[model samples]
Target chain A: MTEQIAWIAVDWGTSNLRAWGIGPAGAVVATAGSDQGMGKLAPQEFPAALMAVANQLALPDEPVDVVICGMAGARQGWLEAPYLEAPTDLIALGQGAVHPNMPDERLRVSILPGVCQREGGENVMRGEETQLLGLAVTAPTYAGLVCMPGTHSKWARLEGTRIAGFSTAMTGELFELLKTHSVLRHSLAGDVNGPERDGGFLAGAQDGLDEPEKLLGQLFEVRASALLSGRTPDWCAGYLSGLLIGTEIAANRNQIGTDPVPLIGSATLCALYARVLAMTGAAGRVVDSTEVVLAGLKAARASIA
Target chain B: MTEQIAWIAVDWGTSNLRAWGIGPAGAVVATAGSDQGMGKLAPQEFPAALMAVANQLALPDEPVDVVICGMAGARQGWLEAPYLEAPTDLIALGQGAVHPNMPDERLRVSILPGVCQREGGENVMRGEETQLLGLAVTAPTYAGLVCMPGTHSKWARLEGTRIAGFSTAMTGELFELLKTHSVLRHSLAGDVNGPERDGGFLAGAQDGLDEPEKLLGQLFEVRASALLSGRTPDWCAGYLSGLLIGTEIAANRNQIGTDPVPLIGSATLCALYARVLAMTGAAGRVVDSTEVVLAGLKAARASIA
Candidate 1:
């Protein structure tokens, strides 16, 4: 049964490593993940980490072609896979993949290159490029705005198979920093649930969309609201989340059109972005991130083959 | 010489405390400070902390009035000195001062109340209100916008002696959090100085003032600039500082008039604000925080007398 293992697909990022074992028909047979992300590994240690994850699948005697994407190919990662400058052809992403020198004979590893926009204020994306590639492969004729929400949320303008341009927002990172480290942490002490959370989120999103410029001034209101109006910690947390997400959407509002934007990310995050998008009289639909990354990996594998 | 001590003025904040002993003519005769801030002490323990700082002055046998401001007057501090709702009369700020019962007979402590805005938006200021009062006392007829930059930078609109309205921006706190804890920390590793620092700061300030609404999208550019262009850590730090400050100023730009804005706080911080304000085609003058606070305490003392 293990002999049916055709090749491997991996999405190795800064904080986590996810690998999928695909069969001959381009379907996932086995899947594995670990906390051994690029941030925690030295260049030499990457081989062992990859092997450990692959060993769980019980590979055959023959070597397996492993198509890897993300920070694993960063300058500080296993081997530097230099970025492909935008506007890059998503289908041709595999043309820039770099083969890292792996000691294990069974692992034929090719790390995909990220996309960099050097001309327009210097922006780069590693794993998201593959996901964008996956989006391109999944919907061959798709074109418009695609939103991928995460620690560094990216919004890309896709024209056919080409990524014309894109921008990254530190919304998720800022929200986490404010929640865990800032003075607002004292006010946002509890977890929120139910209608209270929903109402707070919508109210905050409205404020953010209405006056994104006044975000700095309004942030202190979280503390002030807690102190003076007795707003609960749950409300504060929901409001902060909505405010950041809303502001992120508002910043990119000009690019958004009448068509439903395809949000490719984790279900939870995409749902939040979708809700915020709806408030702007725009629509969004969540596309499974794992599915697209796998499709993207498969496309890269086919290109290399 | 110690016998000439008339009263004491103290600014007890979240992380630090400072006390000044006044002589017969209302001049600073002695000064002392400690890390025993209101945040560190229990309500009962506040008396001991105050005594420790006052003991440095070798107080006379007679009872001494201790005038306090800042977080020491908050509901969570030594005693809950209720906030005086805005539009508050700056000269009459002392009318809301609360006295916590002291164990030592010689300590006659009066904690000044903070000002709160409940109508337009939830906003509050503690120690800065006293600085506003000090500004009022020093320039009795002067009326304009006063900026106090700190952990929570404040902007107050002064209509003669009355505070018409004000707003708070979490600019300083955001800068610290992003520099120390966010992903930007990796790119901003070293201290910057001289022309490069100034240049980076001005460039970032200009961008921030020009398009404050796009701040969320622009934050990631810091990291991108470092990765693509090999920008120095000094440049990154200076740029981040300027960007946040500039955005803060831009948010409050409508309130700023042709008059030179008065910046009150630590010299270094106020200087940064002044530079950013200048970038907006407005002038700023740094006011000595200590002198103004002393004058504000003196004004409060006069009110009590």
Candidate 2:
């Protein structure tokens, strides 16, 4: 019954879980995802949850060769795979795997290791490892800065198949904290997106990156001026967005180190990052790295085959 | 009744509404506080909510003098008292009271203004304004730095009876967010206190304040290291506490202007701030500001009386 086994690939992130079923040639057959993100799932429950998705593909309980990526490989997940330090390369990933609850009856499952950063000091990245691998493949013709921007924006320096180094900025998370928890929330109007919104976000981002020293002090004005002087809440969001992302852009202008950085992520997300990057006079091209995740998944599956 | 009317005091904060029937000598004859804090009550409900407490004293409904100093007068409170700007004196406070539902109600209620700051760029402080006022009164000779520590740590500079400037750090809120919402919660062991545990709080605080340039980049390590390394979860609090307090301390080191900052707050809270302060070679003194809040309440009440 071994007619060259099909491919199994999964992307397990903090808030999302995506799985794909591919033919022998890495052609997509079926795909599935659920709100059962790694952040919310119980340790022992990952197997059953995975099987539920496999069932959706009608692939039965037989665990062909499944390769997983993201935070799922952290100590809290199915296994405690350590991160590879920066100046990391593809071969630096080594062979990492997590034996889930259904292990005895399982066919095969391998979880990828994330990156452990120790430049100025210690830092980490889990799911981005897979994204980087995908990035390397997708950007093969292109060699420069490959960035995956999200809650923690990641920038990877890749040459050929090797990931030279990577850095992260808590841009999105800071934005969330400032908006929801900080006093800045009071000044910001609820919605950040609308039609009458006269291009406030990019402008805010520009101003933020320009003057970071004034960042912490100006936070009050965003709210006060909005309340007292009637600044739009959208502007507040844009201003805050600017402060976080702009601070990141300014601080890492050297680490990211390039004239043009290729932003590789979902369309909307890449746009957001690109907008911030635009302020630095950095050239940016939005590339969809989704194919790379699937490609990396296929490559990982092929290794076992 | 008139003779006993020494000081009518109130601690009208966010989640709890409290009023004390103080004698001319500032002694509590009757104390009443309700779940009817500003957070729980609507703007229109302030009259009835406050009246419910005053009714307990059998005090006349039409006119009674009270000096309130708490979250009650915050922007989110029943009445939005204007924020007192930095480098401000008590005289700089906003005029007019938060006329409760009762339009002509003469139960003279003077809600103090929260502090407004424009340092570096952010604005913060509310409940601390009253405490700062109390500190000036109680520590008549005390000057330099006064830190009112809590979920949000407020660092203020008091030049005699006047407040020069202050800043609010989201240190406490960070602790809560990381412990409850972030990945750190999973491997977390315990608090930053106890004989077996000083936790990592002090160390974290020191680390945070150590260097301002590298502050934001180092935040993720607190959680990541605690999980991957032998760092305890209880230390997570300290690590976070250090980052926040440390950052504030470093940023305001100039504003604190090379002087031993004395912490003025409740005994327990003062100790915590002092412990962190000690690590920085900055001496600290705990002044029981509860009495000062009462005193400030008294003085405020006397003015209207």
Candidate 3:
């Protein structure tokens, strides 16, 4: 039996590609993901990759629209979907979507533009704008702080349906670099993350929040703590994570207003952020990231339609 | 005519081995260096590597006293010279020197133990301890603050001839990691350090000094600023150096005390630091690292004699 498909939603980032097959009522009927992300794909290779996923999930014999977000719209991705200047309404992201020419008659694709900040300090975001759109759709009149934690974590200020300002912290990247490439690697034994309530993690986070400026000095303590006191690798990992996240939250704590900040990311990562937020006397709630992405894509489709 | 090498002072770090042949009066008569750093050598390979350097710089037929510092004394280096816990007397570093076995009768070597802080936040130092010893010898009554900038930058508080407390910052290593491995690499083009008065560098340092916690965010701005404003690679390099050093200084500013902090490093790096210190309302004086190392080794030689 051929399944009826409304459209395809894709989030192509630097290291991974995720595709979702949506039904008529915004239900995800099938999902596919692979390592063939924007970093690995060339402009010409995008269609074949998309086709492979589309063919695997057999659908009705008719033309279907495909809306993509994330790095797929980056300058080096499939095609440049120029960024939509911030202070622009989040729900209206579709207006800035750019359609790329496709050889396949059965596929019609629209790549959504990211958000770019030109003033104050220059900043840019790709797929996160779609997540913001999802938040705007779920709560049309919502306006406050939203934290998206990942490789390049973003803290955004949303006002009603528009994004007022945002800042990106290279927390995840720094962690990876320090763990894999820096001297701190010698001190760590295995996995660095565990439960949110770990004492070491809390202690490290508290220290970071208390003295965010002391980050450079605090990092060396991880190795010393491990060497001098025989600290376990897991504890070291927790401490390092706590320190990074704690510093990030402390740096941006002023942005949190009356509304409880909503965290949009993976469950594990969001839990970490939520815990750190709670420790810092701020309220944070984790929302389902996949659901938000799907909803965001659906909203974008409606605007274009 | 062979030079009269009374002793040898060696600073063997992770990446390079530098050996200075000292005359009777503590002046460097000959110098030799190689890539035989601790990272690349095993215990069995140390003798051959040292012999190669000693043979190149001809001296007396009899064994000469040698004082080794830095990672050469690490557990994984030539042999373990366990850290001397602080508050250790700088003048007594030689008393803790460990002698590694050598088959060659032409060399008598003593490796200096580094300083470590076991409580209140664990910290450790290796080569910098020797430099501190040199500072003690050069300025007997000097007691206040000292900043040694490098891969693992150290900031120490000195009281009389003892090291009261010290902290290490991963400023240099972090800068290298981000510039070579992170996304910011694309924005950078050439060398990382430039002139002192470079406007971009100064501004970045000022920003970092003002808000050290915002480092993670400010790093991203470098990329965005480059893409949006076409910032040159030299400017980016200076800005990055400024940011890291600035953050480090701001974090450790309380340790500066009443006297001008003395910077113990290479001339170029010390100049950069001196500029930053002046910017932060603190005076910094540059001291020759080699001279300090020779002075330190000579002092250690006296104690062991």
The residue-by-residue lDDT of candidate 2 on B42-141, one tens digit each, is 7778878877887776574446676677777766677776776677775334242343345536466778767666544445566676666666766677
Q: What is the C-alpha RMSD of each candidate to the true structure, in Å?
A: 1.7, 4.8, 2.3
TM-scores, one per candidate: 0.97, 0.80, 0.95
Quote the positional error of residue A43 for candidate 1 in Å: 1.0
Which should have the higher DockQ, number 1 or number 3? 3
True C-alpha contacts between chains kept, each model in order: 0.80, 0.15, 0.91
A-chain TM-score per prediction? 0.97, 0.88, 0.95
DockQ of 1: 0.80
lDDT tens digits, residue span A1-305, model 3:
65578889988888888888888877888888888889999999988888877776665678999999999898889999988888788778888888888898799999999999998678999999998988888887778889999889999988767999899999999988987898888876575554432777888889889988899999999998877787877788778888999999999998787677899988988998988899878888898888888889888877874
lDDT of 3 by residue, B1-305 (tens): 76699888889888998998888766778999999999999999999999888877785887898789999898889999989999878788888898989899889989998999987679999899888888888888889989999888999888766899899999999989988999999878665444532877798899889889899899999888887677777788778889999999998887677678889987888888888899978899898888888788778766763
> lDDT: which is higher, 1 or 3?
1
Best by DockQ: 3
lDDT of each residue in A148-247, candidate 1, tens digit only: 9999999999976799999999998998999899989988887656456777788788888988888888888889999999888888888888888888
Candidate order, DockQ descending: 3, 1, 2
The TM-score between candidate 2 and the true structure equals 0.80
**In candidate 1, residue A78 scores what lDDT?**
97
